[model samples]
Target: MQSSAKTIEQYLLELPEERKSVMNKLRNTILENLPNGFKEGIAYGMIGYVVPHSIYPSGYHCDPKIPLPFMSIASQKNFVALYHMGIYSKKELLDWFVSEYPKHCKTKLDMGKSCIRFKKMDDIPFELIAQLTQKVIVEDWISMYESALKR
Candidate 1:
């Protein structure tokens, strides 16, 4: 999945036709709803965004520039994935999602402890996804990162 893309736009442009459409839609949705200081780009051969360590200096996950929180969109041969790091840091948010998600849909949200996997765009709850992204505000994430520097 090594992208030929030199930039995010190139990344989007490189995707196969159908995947391009879905990924672009999702990318737009996320950009529209994203809290300030968050940004979108490519990482690990996927379409994703990272909270840069330049802002946090110590990256919210510790190790500063070595590791940072990311939300990614993966277009595999079969399915698409909307993935994020926030699910691992906050229990309240996870609890809310677990309780609310199953109440509305019969199929499970194919998510792990942190990752959310979706085969199709229609399978995702746009509002829920938006809120989940919203939960980790930039200030909070930066605070967590900056605190790591103090330790």
Candidate 2:
């Protein structure tokens, strides 16, 4: 199903009290774990952390204004999801996960082209995931982006 269309704050504002608390906790965990140069904002109603297009205008195959977001966090009716596009585009990273996940993670990290879903904080692999966020460097990403723009 398509994600909702509210801003991150608006989406939280609209949730019922209990879900709000849950989302808040999940949001905080994500924020606290975020690495440097990744910006957090509302995109398509989820908590999106992106390397702005201005930083990587040509990294993605799209309009320059489009963002090259590394990750997105969203809370659904029954779960929360962490969308990491790097996992799909960078096979070395995904391979790392494949080899290490069973030992480091406790739950089945669902895959979509790149999304990782969790039903609760208890289902998440906090430390390793934090490492996942740090694996890609903004400097290198910017370099790659500039290289793409030159093509």
Candidate 3:
């Protein structure tokens, strides 16, 4: 569900009490692994990591006013979702994630093009998540995003 929170703190406070710990774990992983230049804030109603207007003045091609989004973590109605734009835009990254995640987590992955859904806390592979988050630097992400826009 989309949150009505204006800030990350507000977003955390608004989430169901049962989901706070899981969210915190995932948030911590993202924060620890997230490269410099990507700012975290509430975007599209979720906690989002984005290339701010300061770095990418063009903003998101889809919506020029909003920052260019890289990743987001959200507590959905039935599951926790981790969305990674790199995986969505890069086939090699997608392949690597799909193959390596199961090996690392030892659990079947439930994922869509860019959204990985964790139905329970144990389903999350914290280390693997960090690794994935670290794979694409802000510059690389901007390049990939710009290349996709050319298509």
- Per-candidate TM-scores read 0.78, 0.74, 0.97
**lDDT agreement of model 3 with the native:** 0.94
- In model 1, which regions exceed 4 Å deviation? 1-4, 59-67, 103-106, 143-151
Candidate of highest TM-score? 3
lDDT scores for all predictions? 0.70, 0.70, 0.94
lDDT of 2 by residue, 72-151 (tens): 77776666677877776667888997677778777776777777777755656766776777787777656555654577
Model 1, 118: alpha-carbon shift in Å? 0.8
In candidate 2 the C-alpha lDDT for residue 74 amounts to 73
Model 1 CA lDDT for position 112: 85
Query: Relative to the unseen true structure, what is the Cα RMSD of model 1?
Result: 3.1
Per-prediction backbone clash count: 0, 0, 0
lDDT of 3 by residue, 65-105 (tens): 99999999999999999999999999999999988987777
The C-alpha stretches of model 3 lying farther than 4 A from their native spots are none
- For lDDT, candidate 1 versus 3, the one ahead is 3
Q: In model 1, which residue pairs have backbone atoms overlapping below 3 Å?
A: none
Per-residue alpha-carbon lDDT of candidate 1 for residues 42-130, written as tens digits (9 for 90 to 100): 67777767777665555544444543666787776667777776665567777888777776556777878767767755666766767
* Model 2 CA lDDT for position 40: 78
